[model samples]
Target: MGKGPMGGGGPHGMMGGGQKAKNFKGTMKKLLVYLKPYSISIFAVILFAIGSAAFSIVGPKILGEATTTIFEGLVGKVTGSGVGIDFTYVSKILIFLLGLYIVSAAFSFVQSFVMSGVSQKVSYRLRKQISEKINLMPLKYFDTKTHGEVLSRVTNDVDMMSQSLNQIMTQFITSVTTLIGVLIMMISISGVMTVATILMLPLSAVLISFVVKRSQKFFKTQQEFLGHVNGQVEEIYGGHNIVKAFNGEEDAIREFNKLNDQLYNSAWKSQFLSGMMMPIMTFIGNLGYVMVSILGGYLAIKGSITVGDIQSFIQYVRSFNQPIAQTAQIANLVQSTMAAAERVFEFLDEEEEDQFAENPVKINNPMAGVVGREFQEESNKKSHHHKEAEREVAVVNEDEIIEIEGSVQFENVHFGYSEDKIIINDFTANVKPGQKVAIVGPTGAGKTTMIKLLMRFYDVNSGAILIDGHNIQDFNRHDLRSIFGMVLQDTWLFNGSIKENIRYGRLNATDEEVIAAAKAANVHHFVKTLPDGYNMILNEEASNVSAGQKQLLTIARAILADPKILILDEATSSVDTRTEVLIQKAMDNLMKGRTSFVIAHRLSTIRDADLILVMKDGDIVEQGTHTDLLAAGGFYSNLYNSQFEDSHEEAV
Candidate 1:
């Protein structure tokens, strides 16, 4: 709460022992923008805020009158100035002030409750939008930022903004209102007393400004340092085994200590500044007290003012200073929360991909000199079915089938993650419907990159990708992604029943359909042997399931979806020889009547592929049928020889 456990001071990325805080007005302004949608809730909070503030103004005045009445009653009874003592007036005023506090308390509760509910709902909407945006963002975005840092923007930063809404708006309005009301009372009571009382204003203001500036800097630094530490912790958690294997315990601890120290120093500065606020103010308050006593006392004795007037002036001075001092303490919390707001707003501002496909490429539309007599007789029926099939697989459309041709073509494509690095250079490929293609390569050879491009994960820099005779880019993104079922090297499984895991492929699929798909993938037997069969509760990421089992489950899930274009990346890489053989058989049957792309490490799977692209350094050096490429005496020949035919070590 006080800049957390670690301390660093100054605006984000500041270095050294101390740094000055920036003005908080700009940060606060940016934060208020998120509240625009909840204007009604904001207005409600303001109305209550004003109610509480007015109650506060009335409270002290009532209490002061009660005190004056009691003093007059005690002194008047002794003198017997033809007046008897009466306690009823003082007690009634005290009761009225007490009632004001009770009502103010109720308003405070309502303001906090309503504002928090509205803020949380907005947080949910913003997070959902951000999640959808990232889902469609090009892979380049994540490459430049860690998953943890991105998560922080969603979870931690958004929460910080939400948590501060009540404190920021409600308290700020109440304090400001109280300050104005108190000043109005002071100026009316006595002109000379009011002027004299305000003389201490300049000194108190300087102390507050200095402390607020210092605290804000420290708090901002604290937020940045905490984010850095969170990112580091996430990385270590992901690679804990690898770290321990490499003897990185000491290194990890040292890195943590460095982050710890920055947190420590920043927190120290913020609290030190916050701590000084009260004392410096108290010292200034004491000076005002002494000055008012001497001046006020002389005026009272000279009959220039009454004793009650002097007492009330002293009371008014205390009321004004107390709020200013209290508000100064939460300044650090306000600034730290505001810094987090900036990071969250950055994510909320990211652009989303195109969603509409009102006029996609027609089956009749074709590139110059590309369409031929071979497609003439049945092209219309084929295109109609293709679009309908695509619509069916789209997640958003449970009942309608999206139309898209299964045929795909990359035409002289050039692309890269950034200006400095070109990943795909002049790449071109053609996949007729229902062709089984295999892409093999060494690490960093753009094998996966090709698959991503086919899925429209990124747009080509120069050329176009076409499905059937139409450019794929012209199609709706939902329709485009729905047609392909992808199973990556790393598997992700949600926490749910075994049946639910398979049903994730197509949410509308029946339980019987899921079981049938599992049987096709040879995973049904394993599920039956489990304690609860389809209803068994799966652990997070499916840890209870073996790695091979996890792979099989996901594949079965994909089979249920029955995507026209199947992407199996190292589908058998994790299983043993026997299981791999079983899986390979299941995979062969699965690929028989549908277009498939396979990336496998074992040499046997791709031997009969319609096309095998051997890639290295982001370029395809050889492409053809297995028999044809081997006969060509090129890069493919050399690769097959080393990988398969130790017997035939032929010189190129």
Candidate 2:
């Protein structure tokens, strides 16, 4: 089966929406820790925001003075008793009002610039932490989650938090400051009119609460369905070939339509409800304006307020309703920010792999003994064969390093992917240094699990794995893994040049060494035929090359690593018969002085193996040399005979 974008699982395998923060208050408190480092920047943002609001708030009142000056001058002109229209005084008020607005704009610009920087810095730090956390997290943590899910925490969630933070921080401060400042200014102008504006607030509040409450669920459902739609698209596209091969296009389209329909319904309802808020509030605000206008005209007639005061009160009324609307929107934004923060923090808080052992045993040049010397001689012979580029073998000081003969012992091992299902039971094996042991088994016989356990990818439940009489756990995980090189059925190559991909096995390997390793794996000839040769770039999926070539490249990588223990899991499965023969020869040369564990489905390839382990249902039923096992006429005989019988039937 072809793997989907999310490792073969469909949309239902992904995290569903409505995943709001369980403890929003607590998550916000934790998010404050990230903000703590930028407290000064945030404080500056708040101050600037307040300054912007304060300056802008005073503008209308100052403009009111200019209006009052013009009004008095016009009255004096009509009465013919005083100078008409004091142009000088009005000009001064107009200039002062312009200055106030300029200062307000300046404050707003500074705050926006500072807050943007702070938000990006926080995002950068969180992404960096999550990237580092991924390396420290246990493999088990990843096994349960899809790749898209983990990536969403890094990309989608972080972006959401950052964008929301950037907008909300300045918006919240400015809204509150404007609300309070405008209220005070309104009261100064006319308490009676201010009270009239204030009375409309209850109606505004009731309307806002109603819209927000009704729309919130639809918004959440929209978000959920949106995720589902995205997941379906990603999965379908990623495995489009398989879908077509099986004629599943109609089914795929049907599923997509189902999700898309839900998305449409939720999205429109949410948008319609949210869109109604402003218009509804505007109607109520207009009613308040009518009331305030009548009150202000009465006060003006009775000499209780100036025309300028009435103008200022009206401006304040518009300002007042805005903050109330923004406050409701900010509440929703805060919820989203907290939810994003919670996911990011949750990923950061995942259980990490125990990387370092207490008083860790350090193994140095484990192949520095007799096996190392023989391997060096063999490598020298292979280097001589590569006339274009000579191999550069690392020479280590034997005196400073302890020799690990690559002898492995699995003592009464028991393990499962989970605690409830024991797939490997009472497994025991002993492998001496430089032995070529082949494990042959039916599918689901725990062949791969044994290798994983040997490498400490997953520790055995009740027994210990030992290398040279030392428990594997005693060694640091990095140091322990360094002893082995693996080439599996599924070959992995990243998007890089062929040379870089091979050099990944040994980062410090020289160009000459890489070429030599490629030649040793029988990859140099085929690589030379390709465009750009070793410099050819692999695409993201590495699909530019054939499957067998990819497998060969991986083998070349392992050869370059020159590990003390070699693991070959259906390593030559992708290659043709002739290419397999060539690869098998190269593998024989590579395995000469290293302890090798070869898991093979084709039994013919391993007839010369020093030990053939026959496993069925998680238990090794037979283990001996091929000749010995065949002579026993037991489980190995039946398995060996059955394979040949199938081949003969196909041949006939």
Candidate 3:
């Protein structure tokens, strides 16, 4: 039942070779902290496992008693001695052995059950922590990491930790208990045979160590190639249409085949090397078993040990090497688990955004300058006149002492994605409440960078952006973002009904309000044409709807938000001419009463903008009304003129 020391599960143990984790000790120590909560359950598991393995360890000795009894009975009968067989003694030993195995099985079952729950609970908590960590991490962290890599840490790495931790904990306890109990029983029977068995341990260990050392490089390479192949598949599949359109199918296949072949080579080599450990360990174990058996028989013949003792010692010697092999396997599994845990721990340890202030800004409130209800009477009393008292009541209703005027200004703002390279340099702009300010620039210009700075996606290296005369940093990120809404060229709609997508901008918006917003965005008619109207479900990528329709939905979302400021990033760039006209009209309606920033490639769209900020290489080269800039015959005029010239050249 216990594999008698030489028996084992499989050679998959060696497949974990070459994965010696960096900072393994520290990672394991940190991982153990997560286990602290389940200490009681883990303790119970260990106890049950030890009991189970101990029962198995003692079974062979008891069975040996029965064997010796049978042998003696036969010998006595042949020699014509009195009272030849002790039937009652043999019967009792057989019954006790059966009971021992049953109890051992029960203990093992309980250990597995308890360990299952502990592992699952830890997995749940790890996932919860990762979810929270995602929100806490800054955008910059995501910008630097691949989405697949991040997801692997969350899903694959955590899963590995969960599975390996469960098995390792139970096996480690059982193996140690079995090894100890078996050794003690062997020594009690025949010390000489025990010493002979122990001598083979060093040889078995050295052999395992050699194979593991050779296989580690293969394992690491296999993992790397596996990742490369997976990435290639994901990229090629995700862009299948593009690849086909470009007639690059052969190239993609060739690259994939190359990576696949490399992965196969490493995988095969690693497995072969790891597989060698099992048979090698088995051979060494069998050698020890043979040595113990020979000495055991000699000792019994010389009357130094009984036949029963010889049988039990042989069983011990046979079982000894399996635990040693198991120990080596567990050690490798631990290294693998630690590597995964390190990734998870690193994610958990990422830098988080600043804590929200106790008294966060209230720009979302229409009357943001108001204090609170407690000061209402005092403010009313201070302002005696009726109009003044009314204003006082409004002022007292809001907590933060900030007004919501929606006037935004960039005051000598300078910023860069990286510290060493400055992308936006000492640029400044001002937009009055309800003004439409358009930013126009060449491909390398800092139009989007300016928008990102305004939204605090990336903080400026120097200077500041202000809303209603208060520095952007003065407002909590949540409160600050709540005051502005954005509709970008890339529309994002989750897997939900069209109505739900619109309601996402303002979660508490009613069905009627959603319809009104859709109507304002000119997508209401299109929705009505669908069988389910607003209830139509969008697919995961929102591909069920047309690109233009998706754009309209986003605009509808932005309109529903009713933010004090709006940012439109090429919002109508992807639509057909007719759809573009509808989108432009909807966007105009959305921006009517909000201070808006528009970044558009189309010069015609921004011709009527209140102020046009023309940029080149992070600098505001020209800033004025479109007519004024065109009349001045400067960079703005040339940029505006080049559009028609390019079209003419293309037509020719």
lDDT of 1 by residue, 166-211 (tens): 5667667777777888788777666777788788889888877877
Which tens-of-lDDT digit does each residue in 1-652 have in candidate 2?
A: 1111111111111112233578988898878877998999999999999999999999999888888989988999999977989899889888888898999999999999999999999999888878867865777788888887888888878887888799889999999999999989998888888888888888888887787677667766776777788878989999999999999999999999999899899878777777787798799889988998899999999999999988888888889998888887777667667777888888877766665566555567533333434533654454211134544444445453556789998888889898999999888888899889999898999998899898887888888899988899977667778789998888899999999999988877899999999999888999999989999999999999988888888889999988999999866766688878777777876788999999988888898888888898888889999999999999889988998899899999
TM-score of each: 0.83, 0.90, 0.90
Residues 1-652 of candidate 3 have per-residue lDDT tens digits of 1101111123544336455568988887877777898899999999999999999999999988988898899888989885677889999999999999999999999999999899888888888778866765778899998787788776777887888888898888988998999999988887788888888888988887888888888877776777788778878988999999999999999999999899889878887887898889889978987887789788888989778887777777777777888888888788777777888888887776652433445564532223222233343343211122233112223444555778988899888889999989999888889889999999989998898888787889999898988888877666677788999988899999999999998877899999999999999999999999999999999999999999999999999988889999976666689998998899999999889999979898898899999999999999999999999999999999999999999999
Question: What are the Cα lDDT values of the candidates?
Answer: 0.71, 0.82, 0.81
lDDT of 1 at 169: 71
Off by over 4 Å in 3: 1-17, 82-87, 357-359, 366-398, 401-403
Runs off by more than 4 Å, candidate 2? 1-19, 366-401
- List clashing residue pairs in candidate 3: 4-319, 5-319, 18-216, 370-395, 370-398
lDDT of 1 at 1: 16
Model 2 residue 370 lDDT? 37
Tell me which of candidates 1 and 3 scores higher on lDDT: 3
